[model samples]
Target: MSLTAGGPRRDDFFKVPGKGAGAPVKPGEKAPVDRTAALSVGAFQPVVAAVPMPQRLFEHERERAAARAAGEDATRQLKNVGADVDVALTTAVLLLRGVEHPKARERVVGAVPQLAEAADYRPLDAAADFLGLDHEDAAEILEELTEHGVAGPIAEAAVRVEELRAQVQQADHEQLDELLEFLLPVSALISIAGAAAPLGALTEGDPHLAEAAKAGVVGLAAVALQELHSTEHPNVELESTELLEALTPPVR
Candidate 1:
């Protein structure tokens, strides 16, 4: 089900009090003031307070801290992996260039250097490109060199590069997951607030009714959001899918 099915319109949320739909003014009669509309905005504030806004704010801060820590760790790991990738690519390129094997020399001559430069900032891409170049009859040539005790040290550099590339990809995915985890609760709260707005609008005039309504709406919104969070709601899935598509690398 749509999370925001009956929520206020984007413009309605920002509309001035006493300016919404009201009884029309007759030709010479002054426009009647809408006390209900005027009171709606003030009434909604209590509803917002009824929800644990302060608690949610605290939780949001904690999530942000966690996300920041995850991001820093990912950055550190990627930096080390990038250095390793550069070293591995350089070793593989140099060794393949020196090899007398016609196919290996033909493949690594000038292409590897350009690919390396093209993906200079993108370590994962660089590793994949280098591995791709090395996989085509090139590994066999490197094995032959190893059998002859030639270029034996650099022969396994491609394998090391592949392992390093996997680490980079894993680090990136972990960072994305952390970001998504932080965002999920934020989205749920926004949905809850929107759903609660209309219910709060109904209790404008009576102070006691307003208080009771605020409590009821807050409880209802909390329950609804909890259920939506636990279930595989289509709206939640759509948001997650969009975020993944936007943040994930094309190479993966």
Candidate 2:
């Protein structure tokens, strides 16, 4: 029997430039247009000169606006992270996306002080930052995701992940799929089960350590969550019935 090797790529080592990466955009590439600029342009009214404008122009503008909105939303979520925890958080996400970078790995494994710090790291934003996937990439992938399967459960799972993030304890084996599904593009949730589907292998054993040779969503995120839960950011004694219900493995 033959098997495929799933792993990081050469490009995974390079940091993807976000909105203000201070680098020029390549030809044919979309410039980092801010959300406001994209939206304002969308409301543009061309002066009529006794000629009907092409519909394609409006379609192009709409697409650009959408891309900016998605990108902006992702950026907003990441901006809230404190500098202290950003690298570790992002690195864990890189594992989830299967794009491990040396820099991220170094920080994730390096210091005890670094791991002990806690914050309200929003799961969706962390997922977006980790992948560094462009808005158009998300938009394009979303179409393919929707055409092939039902995505409602996957998106709902993303919400459930937020609840998981709020927990002060490590997640158990049963919540494995929910952990990964939260990272997938909503429209594609049921399609590939997330690009980092290999994370499923880490769902057993201690449910706490759930080790993997290659740090994955469950394994890497577990490290970060265990640290965050160490201090109990929201409340040490908080209880979440809804989160528990959402993670309950469905009866087959």
The best candidate by TM-score is 1
Expressed as tens digits, the lDDT of each residue in 1-252 for candidate 2 is: 000111222221121233232246677865532222222221211211111111222233234335455664433222222111222222222223331333334433432122122122122222222333333432332232223211112223322333333220122222221322222111111111122221122333211111121222233233323222111112101111222222222221
Model 2 clash pairs are none
Best by lDDT: 1
Give candidate 1 regions above 4 Å deviation: 1-186, 189-196, 202-213, 220-229, 237-252
Question: Candidate 1, residues 28-83: lDDT per residue as tens digits?
Answer: 85553322223333343443334432233334434434545666544543343333
Model 1 worst lDDT run, 10 consecutive residues: 1-10
Against the reference, the lDDT scores of all candidates come to 0.30, 0.25
Residue runs of model 2 more than 4 Å from their true location after superposition: 1-81, 99-212, 216-220, 223-228, 231-252
Q: CA shift at 161, candidate 1, in angstroms?
A: 42
